[model samples]
Target: MKNYTTPILILFLFLVIAIIGNITISAIGLFFNHDVFNTGVYANGYEASLNIKLIFMAKAFALLMFIYSVYILIRNLKFLVRRDFFNNKLVQCFSKSGKLFFFSGIVGFLASICGILNIAIIKDFGSQAYLNIDSKSLYIMLMILGFFLLLFSKVLDKGNEIQQENDLTI
Candidate 1:
């Protein structure tokens, strides 16, 4: 229990801001990039009209949810300092965080899969200015970590019950 609230809070906020920025840019590019779409990125007559904006937005959405789960997991750490180890809120946080992380990871990975299935011309891979990077490996890690956290939460709940019963006996 290193009291990781502050750092995690900062990370959550940063991820939120990044998601907002991504959505904003994606929406702007979708709604208004007509001026540049035909001339700039579509240089080779690759007529993939179905842009991958939705996939990009989907990844952003997943990242937002993933960080939000982490935010919830760390939000109630005050109970840990108070030596209240058996609080239901702590268990609930872990449970909810695990579920959300799993869901987010699945969504992100599926989005990537869909993106890959699309015609490559639907999105410009080389013309991006470096900020449009998305990582499949990251999503895979999220899925694995989420599953472990879920199992850990169950173990923690059982331990909490045992500790409470011992306390009552004394």
Candidate 2:
């Protein structure tokens, strides 16, 4: 397990760097692309007023949360590498990651709702707001995964206590 840790850490670091780079490039593009805010058909097959800064802000917030979750995962992996798998710090990191994931999902769901609302407001009965199934499902999945991660953290904490007792007995 120790021998595998270094390679896994390296892979995770590469993924973190890649995701950060993608986010940075996207931010730069959004900054330069004035048309991003213009009224247009979104990728979700809905027509909406895309010019609102709130839309961008929501997306940015969600992305940041995702990054934070990944960072927490990295911290958890660091504990594993250090052979501190059952430590409180590791459990805390897992808990934090779960919260971030849940929050990000909510942000994404709200952002989609905002887009639909924008369309309905601008069109004024001419257009109807439709539910975005993909976004809704993704958000639901993320929240579920986050909830399980948090539950796992509690199990880890219990395991840690048991391990400590066994160590002392030995």
| Counted clashes in each candidate structure | 0, 1
User: Which digits, one per residue and each the tens of the lDDT, describe model 2 over residues 1-170?
Assistant: 66876776788778667656654544433443322433333434543234444565575577577767876786567688777879999899888888888888888778767766766776432122122222567767778878988998989999999999999999
lDDT, candidate 1, at 148: 84
Best by TM-score: 1
TM-score of 2: 0.66
Q: After superposition, how far is residue 157 of candidate 2 from its true place, in Å?
A: 0.7
Residue runs of model 2 more than 4 Å from their true location after superposition: 1-33, 36-51, 124-136
**What is the lDDT of every predicted structure here?**
0.70, 0.66
Q: For model 1, how does the per-residue alpha-carbon lDDT over 1-170 read when each residue is reduced to its tens digit?
A: 55676776787788778767766665555544532323355454433234466666677788888878877867777777676766878778778888888888899898878777654644555323222445788788888888887887788799999998998999
Candidate 1: regions farther than 4 A off: 1-4, 34-39, 42-51, 120-133
Q: TM-score for model 1?
A: 0.76
